[model samples]
Target chain A: MPHREKTRILLVDDVPENLLALEALIRRDDVVVHKAASGDAALELLLAHDFALAILDVQMPGMDGFELAEFMRGTEKTKHIPIVFVTAGGRELNYAFKGYESGAVDFLHKPLDAHTVKSKVNVFVDLYRQSKVLKHQLETLERNRQEQEALLQELTETQEELRKAITIRDEFMSIASHELKTPLTSLKLQIQLRQRYLKKGDASAFTIDKIAKMVESDDRQIQRLIRLIDDMLDISRIRSGRLTVHPATFDLSELVHDVVDRFSEQLAAAGCTVTLTVPGPVVGYWDHFRVEQVVINLLTNAMRYGAGKPVTIVLEAGDGRARLSVRDEGIGIAEEHQARIFQQFERVVSASQIGGLGLGLYIVDQIVRAHGGSIRVESALGKGSTFIVELPVEGNRASDAS
Target chain B: MQANTLLIVEDDPDIRACLEEIMVSEGFEVLTAAHGREALQALQSAQTLPALILLDLTMPVMDGPQFLAELASGRWPEAWQRIPVLVLTAISEPFLAGGVAEVVRKPVDIGVLIDAVARHLPVSLS
Candidate 1:
C-alpha cells in the first residue's frame, strides 16, 4: 500500500502557552498539530483544512469551547470533526454531560493526563483514515460498473445488427434462385416444344410466323435472366467498392430521350403515356452509359408502380449543375419507407406483385453519387412520387485531369 | 357427349398458355384465370362448372390459401364447391385440404399433371 498523508489535529485554547504545550505532548510522526489561540481562529483553520480531531479548552475568554462546539455542530463542514473538551473545572457529572451534549466525543479534566489525551485522539484519527479509503474504493467500483453496463449494451446492438444482415442475405439468395428457375423452366418447355415439332418429320410444321414467335419469346426470357444476373454482379461490385465510372461529355437531353424511347414499348404495354420535356442541349461531362442507366431505372420504377397512369420526365441544366426529375401518378411510397428505399435489397412492394431483386434504386443512387450527384424523393401516400437527381455539370473531371 | 371443362389458375402467361394447349389437345375444354380473384369471377359467371381445377399456389392478386378459404366459406354457389382442385406449385410441402385432390410440383412433368387431371375429372377426355 502507498504511504498515507499524516493525520491532522487542531489544538485550540485562549492562552497561547496552553496551545503550545498540548501540541508538544501530542506531536508524532504520523500526526500534524495545528495550534489556535482562540475558538474563532480554530474555526478559520478548520475551514482551510480537514483535521481528524480537535482538542479545545472549555474555559476561554472569547468563544469558549462549548460555544465553539455548538457553532461547529451547526455548520456542515466542521460538524463531523471529533472534539475533546479539556477544562480545569471539577469533574462534576453536570459539566461532563454538557460537554458531551456540545458534540465532544470525550471530556478530560485539566491538569490533563498525557496518556489519556493521546489515546483518545489516536482512535478518531484511525477512523477518519479508514473512511477515506472506503469512499475511494466505492467511487472506483461505481465507475467500473457503469463501464460494464455500457459495454453490454453495445454488444447487444451489434448482435442484432448482425442478425439483420444474415436475414437479408438469406432472403436475397432465395429470391435469386426463384427468379432464375422461372426463366429456366420456360426455356426447357420451349425446347421440348421444338423437339416435338421436329419429331413429327414435317418441315412444313416449322412455319415462319410460328418460328419467329417462339424465338421472340425465348429472347425475352433470356433478357430477363441477363438482367437478374447483372443486378447480382452490380451488388457485389458495389459492396466491394470496385464500381468505377468513366467520364465523357454528352448532351443530357439526348441521353434522356434515348432511354425514354427504349422504354416506350413497355410503358405503352402497361398503359402509361410518358411525356419527356427538355429545354435544350444541356451538355455535361459524366459517364454517359451510367447516367443512361439512372434514367432508365427511374423510368422503369415509375412505369412499374404507375401502370395505366401518365408519367412525366423533365431535364433541366443551369447554375453549374443538371437536374432530372421523373414524376409518376401511382401508389406513392409511405413516409416511413422513403429513407430505406436506397438501401440494398429493400423494397416497399411485395415481390409477388412486382418481380425484382430490389437493386434498381440502390444501383442508381450509387452511380449518381459516383458522378458527384445527389438524389431525393418528394411524395405523399395515395399521391404519386417524383424522384429528382442533381449532378454537377463538370462531374468530378477536375480531379481526374489533375 | 358433353366436353369436360378444366380450369387453369396461374399468373404466368407462358405456363397458362402451355397448359391450355396441352389440355385442348387432350380433348378437354379449358378456361384460365390469372389469380384466385379472377378464378372466383370466372366461376360466378360460368355456364357450366369445371370438372377439375389446376390451381397455382402463388399469385399476385390472391393466393392459394385465400382462395381455398373463400371457396369453403360458402361464398360461391353450391355447384362450384364439388369441383376437385389440383395444386401446381414450386413449394416443397403439399397443401392438404378437403377440396384439393393432389399436389403436383413444378417444373411439372407434363404426363404427371395430365394424369392427375384425368383421375379427378368425371370423364377422361384422352
Candidate 2:
C-alpha cells in the first residue's frame, strides 16, 4: 500500500516513429515508458530495469516480435513479465494464434486502435502491481515467524535456569536446618544432664574440677553454635547484596600472624601445628576486617580437615599483588570437586560428616573477588589441598560486583 | 557376656561424653567411640558384646547407615544382629536404616530416650 514507484513499460520497434507513437499514447503521470529501436537495445533496457509489461513491434529487421517474446520467455529474469505482440497482418492470417503460441498475452494490429492499446496495457500493469504487493507481504510474514521462534528458544532457556536456581535454594534450606540443629542438640543434652545431677543433690558431681570441665565443654558448644549462626547471617547479608569492602592500609604478614595466634587454642585442641612462613612484612591496602575473615575461614578449614597433620601458611608480595596460601596435609578434595567448593551450600565432603553451613569458601571467594582479587585451589585425594588468594597491593583495582 | 554394657557411637566429643556419663550414672557399663569405624574396632576386640548400641547417623570414616549395612552383612557374629541399635540423629527426614530398634530425632527428650533404652534392654536397670 505504501509503494510509490512508477509503473514501467518497455516498447521495442525497428520503426522509430512507431515506438514514439506507442509510448506517447500510453504515457501517464504514474507510468514510465522506455523505447528501444532494436531487439538488442530492448534487451539492454530489460536487463537493467524491472518493467511491468513489454510491447514489441511484429515487423522488425532481425528479430521479429514472436522471436523476441520467445527469448523473454526463455530467460529466468524476464520470464515472468507479460508481453504484447503488435503485428501489421490482418485477422485472416491467424496472427492471434501465433502470438499466443509465442507466450504473448494478447495481439495488436498495425494501424492500431488507440482505445484497444490503452485498455489492454492497463490490464497487464494492474496485474503486475497486485503480484508485487503479494510478494512483499509473504516476505514480512516469514521474517515474523523466524523472530517468534528465536523468542521461544530464549524463553525456554530462561525457564530452565530458574528451575535449577529453585532446586539449589531448596537444598540449601534443608542443609542449613540440619546443621543448625546439631550443636543445639549437644547443648540441650549437656544442660539436661547437669540439671538432673543437681536435682538429686549430688555434691560430688559439682566438684571444682568437674565443674571446670563442664564449663569448658559448655563453652565449646556455645562457640560452635555462635559460629554457625554467624555463617547464616553472612549468607543472608550476601543474598541481600549488603556485603561491601571498605579498604584500609595494613601489613598482610601482621594480619596473618594475628589470626593464627588467635586460633592457637583450636589448633592445639585439634592436635595440629601451624608452620607460618612469612619472609617479611607484606603490606597492602585492603578491607582489613574482610581480609582477616578470609584468613580465619581458610585456617579453620585447614584445621578441620588437616587430620591432625601440620598446616602451613605462606605470604608473598610481588608484581603489585600479594599472594596468601594455606596448605593442609590431610584429606584433600578430588579433581571433580575443586570448582564446585566455592559455590553456596555445596559441600563436597558431606558424607564425611564435616560440620558447618558450607558457606565458608563461598564467603571467602566473594570477599576476595570484591577486592578485585582471585582465589584458587590445588589438591588431590589424600595428597592435601592448598588454597591460594591474590590481592592487589595498592587496592586500586575496580571492585567487582559483590 | 557383658549384658549390662552399652556402646555409644557419636562424632561429637561433648555429646559422646554426655551420653557416657548418663549411662554410667544409670548403672550400666559404657564404651565410647568417636565414629562408626572406631565402634566397629571396639566391637571386634571386646571381651563381650554390648547389650545395646546407641548410634549417630552422620559421622566421619563410616556413618550410621554404613555401619548398619556392614553390621547386617553377616560379617560379624549372628548375635550382633539381636543387639538393639537405637539411632540418634539431628536429621528430620524419615530414617532408612534397617534393623533399628528406635529412631530418636534431636534434640532428644531425656525422659523419652531413657524409657526407650530401658524398654529395649534385656534386663531393666530398675
- lDDT of each residue in A1-402, candidate 2, tens digit only: 525877889999998888888988898778889899988898999899899999988778897777787788879888888888787887664453343654436778878899999999999888888888887788889889899989999999999999998987776776667677777878888888889988998888888999898888778778777777777887888989988778888899999999988778778867689999998998888999889889999998998788579999999989999999999998999999999999987877863377667899999998898788899999999999999999998774453332
Residue A183 Cα positional deviation in candidate 1, in Å, after optimal superposition = 2.9
The digit string of per-residue lDDT tens for model 1 on B1-126 reads 778888899866666767776788678888898789989998877778889989987665577767877899887887777899999876555445667888887777777778888788775445
Residue runs of model 1 more than 4 Å from their true location after superposition:
A1-7, A28-37, A44-48, A74-79, A90-104, A200-205, A398-402, B14-28, B56-58, B63-65, B88-126
- In order, the TM-score of chain B in each prediction is 0.93, 0.92
lDDT of each: 0.81, 0.84
- Runs of candidate 2 with Cα error greater than 4 angstroms are A5-7, A12-15, A34-49, A56-79, A83-120, A264-271, A334-336, A396-402, B1-3, B94-97, B123-126
Q: After the best TM-score superposition of candidate 2, give how far the Cα of residue A16 lies from its true spot, in angstroms.
A: 3.9
- What TM-scores does chain A show, candidate by candidate in order? 0.84, 0.81
